[model samples]
Target: MPPSGPPTRPPTDDAGARADAYATAPLLNCLLREVAQPLDGTDEPRVYRLPSGERLLRVRGVRRPARPEVSVDGDWRPVGHAELVKLVAEELQAHTGLSNPELPAEMTDSRDAVAALLTARDGATSPEDPYRRSEQSLLTGHPYHPAPKARGGGPVARWLPYAPEAYAAFPLALLGVREDAVAEEGDVSALDAFGTAPPGYRLLPAHPWQLDLVGPGLTEAFADGRLIRLGTTTSDTWPTAAIRTLYAPEHDLFVKFSLDVRITNDVRRLWRHDLLSLRRTDSVVAAAAAALRTPGAWLSDRGYRTADFAFEELAVLVRDGLHDHLVPGATPLLAAALVEDFDGTLPAGLRDPDAWWTAYLGAVVPPALELFARSGVVVEAHLQNCVIAVDAAGTPVQALFRDAEGVKLLPEVSRAAGWERLVYCLVVNHLVEIAEALRESHPGLDPWPAVRGVFAHESHRLDLPEAAALLSAPTLPGKTNLLLRWTGANGADARYLPLWNPLAG
Candidate 1:
């Protein structure tokens, strides 16, 4: 005290004491010297430029709040740095046969070292439940009210053009009867079918659009607790049309028919009426097959078969667990049911316009670039074809793509649909929808930084660096020109008037 010019006193509370300790604690900087470099490949700080033009970096020091909004006494609050180190130490000992009972005290105590271990673990392990349904159990079952889908068994029903015109069309085939002894209908609800499938078939939930076209069949199926219907599918928004859910009673199997036909004239026009456009959906099926072939995919299906669907080839998959199954991928995201209007009233995390931009550019955009490079095809990976499943940790895991019809393989790249519709669908519609959802959920969250994180995280998986270049690219503020905004545009900047879809309105 006598020697010092000023007096410094530490706070009495535990929080203040902890903070003070953190400031002076010696850190090995292992993250800088070892982990971050190998993971990131460069010394460049993980800095991202915000759309507002400010540069932001990862929240340094202190780290994300240690406390969640709510916590229970027994909950395994995110494995702390010390605990994480212990876990890593155990894993290393098991893998390397290095009996390291203790992670050198220097490493064990380092928070950065723990973080690096977590990062490496993330890269190495593919978590089982990608959709994070375990956290939000509310979304585990049907988003809508459960419908009893069991119906009285009978001969195969006729394929009516419209629900109202049911009597005109002749039966496509016997309801439970099959010409071949191999094919038989099962006694199970539509939900049961989705959970399990027969040896030569797959059952998937029909898209909302497909449900609307078939009118009450889907709702009725849901109500009856068991019934399957077939009809042509509709648009890029949903692809449930012409999809069928067939069950086999004797084999206790469920089969869903997948088609390559577009149900709408709009989608047909968008792709110039080429069957190659169907490749998007086809590619998804193909990718799943390829992924399954790799032991790493960890898929349960025994195998898949290619069958004819309206003159085009559609894939039929057979897997166990029709009644008791866990998709781990589809269950969670669909539960949230993103609200689709621009009321400017979405959540704080999603409301920020910048957040939307970042997600599209960072996470969604790079994959398109990678796909273009690998297959020579730029796919239209819009919302309809893509299923974004979030995990218990609230991280988006796998982006499951379905409905191969929207896919386009270029002639030069393979000549298909060129870049017109592909660009419009992937870049415009799909990206915009995700952006809108993000903006609505986290209004205050910055979009660009999120996108950067996505790009940084995902791009590291690909072989090509060029695909990641777009992460730093700027995005134009999006403007819609539906009929609602039309008259307003004439009052000011006439060029920007139409803001609403006239037909939809």
Candidate 2:
């Protein structure tokens, strides 16, 4: 399939205007969802009141909110992306009675990053492969993040060559760690396939950008022969939506690296604590996926390799490839791409909303619910986490789930907390966006009844008390991302607010 009309490259003469709109949508969504309260507005543009300051706010668009206006001196004034950041900061400080200098800068950085991505796209060639297009199509990044595209305030030149948004693919930087300092776990034989190491060293492929980020810090290691640069691999690995993770098609394997840059909620590092327990978590998730009666698959984080001195910074994780798990002849598409209306790839000219939604629901819902019901595992099946495979006709046939770091097992956390996260990730984060995107085109279509039906069926089949409870609950847990960031809470420490349940009767 040819590459889709990249949403980042609009026909508009002003690239800044396109970048501003792209960046502003998700920021407004975060502000509106987390902090603002709805007001009775008898007008075209919806109005809201920022609860802490009693400031009147108005916004346009349903899915990704845009064209924000705040009332001043009895007149509504349009707020640009920068002004929106300031406005959000002021409202958040008053609302929480806390100060945060970092979030505002991150917000500005996110907008700047979009401008860079837009500029890069003009010169860069988009990948022709359907899967690659789907992976790189997330121009808006996250639907409800204050600064989803923020690249840790780094230079564009440093990250552009490695960015999936720019359809970038490059050979892995091969490093040889002295065997004594080589820290590893589980099956990491896949690393040997990339390139050979020196006489007393083992191969550890690193994300080139990550290597540069931590290179200066590893001066002593290089000096002491603990680490040695063995140059780059022969094959090129294309970056996935998760910037740190890469897919090498020649090997049909995924290699995840730790980059100290913050993307969205947290610093995207493969922490030592997490790596220590990676095997245990991945095994359970794999088993859970195995127990599923439907066509579900889990891309396991098979093993990891890093240096003892700089474990977290230099860590590289090996993940299972799509070839092993996906249905024969089916193409895997990122779930996030489905949420973007202009992604221009799969389901763009989708007809028969009822049938398509049914296929999608069949492909996605069963795996998430059944995994929890049978094995007490929450797979964090959000848009980024889920992968939907479609038949040649562009009809979804299977769902594959990944990222063991995000998975939570029962008894590790309370059943209530796990269930809330499952609902948020699966329903609120994953399904809601896709449903809304579908509704935007097929206006009269109602996806809720089908969703409720699936829930009704699965809950009854598995006798899941939480799923049954959700059928009648007044609200679903909506994560407080904007507030959480503003208050300097841990990204994993999810705090949720109530959203009116569409699943409820």
Candidate 3:
């Protein structure tokens, strides 16, 4: 008899093809669920109900959307605005049962089109429809995100890729051109090196320099020697699709970027940090470098890794050797400085700075003692977005920050006139944000010793009460509703305060 076990079939071209298709499994699943099936073979596209209950369409001639074919710096031909609207509307009508009548009148209006379309598909009109809105809501209006309209009629500093129809939850943006001009057809790792692969992932080592060419708009900038190269790092430990790099030209310092767009439920760990209530926390950390007499400017590209390339791609460039000394581990201090008051309340095992387990607490403690009011602004201060550098003695000597993205600036202060906003941001929002992470990661960690360490390292005359006040105060929850008292896109008020000032009473 034949082998009792299952017989293995020889691998064929079809088998190889099946293996190749796995990379696009997510996209295929999307198409299959959203497109509909036809009763019989017909020349026209057919709508089918997927087993998952999603509507999908199978077009006879149309294939899956291929990776972008155009080269970097190529002339960009947009699908005209009118044509785009027609395409979107037609696609929705053909695939989903909803017709023009079912759509909100606002959808027909070009100004609110996207919003209206989302509402219609979301079943906002009826109570019974089960439509799961995409995750785009998480970041769409996030305070740290650049305003939709450019600040000065120019493109915002950051670039994000957005897919209106697919994975709308993922606020996609272009980082740069792919490293390769052509599809690999065999080994795609080469594409990754060339900037063709998604962010937060690295190509196989065999791939060459992974140089992604810059786009035309920034060509003159590079030709004039306005841009410089920066150093690169690839971290497999972090989420995929994140990249970080730093560059400095004659005057301005720049950071290369990308982010891991996936959302995790570990909200407390990443955002809503407790350390954002510290006093002059930004200055305290920045002062370390001044005291150490370190040279050059600093930028935060900590959220992502930076790739090294010969030329800029899609007009994006990463400079070399800019942040060589800056490393990841230093994050714990910056986080410590943000929150943790030394004097006020004593939780057991927290007061003694000299104790062994408590010794490191002094590293996170403050020197001055005073009752300092806390700010209410919540900050997404995590290890990934912070930087601290230490000296040979293991003393934290310097701090660097970057990635204004995810930064929550108090709307009132951001728009108002004064250094209060900046002070609140550097000290209250950014510096202390990292502190919350340290406290949470190390359960046995005490706030005072760490607070005292920061103050002692910075040469602050130890005043326990003031320092305690700074650390003990609870940072504002980062919820903006209290700041403006109004919600739902009515536009912001002229007076907005990012940091909560309860002392005003």
Each prediction's whole-model lDDT (CA): 0.30, 0.88, 0.27
Tens-digit lDDT track for model 1 on 1-505? 0011111123333432242222112121112111111224323323222122221212122211122111133232333345433433443344344554322232332233222222332233222331211211111111110110101111112121211101111112211111122211222232322344344333433323223333443354334433333332221111121123232333333333332222111111112233333333444435543433111111123333321221112223333322232235323332122322211222222333463354335434554645554545445465434434433333443444433433455453433233434444554446544554464455554444554565455456655453254444343222222111212232112121112221111
The runs of at least 3 residues in candidate 3 whose Cα sits more than 4 Å from the true structure, single-residue gaps closed, are 1-314, 320-323, 326-385, 389-398, 403-435, 441-444, 452-505
Q: Residue 95 error for model 2, in Å?
A: 0.8
User: In candidate 2, what are the lDDT values of residues 161-221, reduced to their tens digit?
Assistant: 9988888899999999999999999899999999999799999899989989998999999
Candidate 3 — number of clashing residue pairs? 85
- In angstroms, how far off is 270's CA in candidate 3? 25
Q: TM-score for each prediction? A: 0.35, 0.97, 0.29
Question: Candidate 2 has what TM-score?
Answer: 0.97
Better structure of 2 and 3 per lDDT: 2
lDDT per residue (tens digit) for residues 346-379 in model 3: 1112333234223332322221011011222222
| Candidate 1, superposed: residue stretches over 4 Å from native | 1-331, 339-367, 412-420, 449-505
Better candidate by lDDT, 1 or 2: 2
Best by lDDT: 2
| Candidate 1 vs 3: which has more lDDT | 1
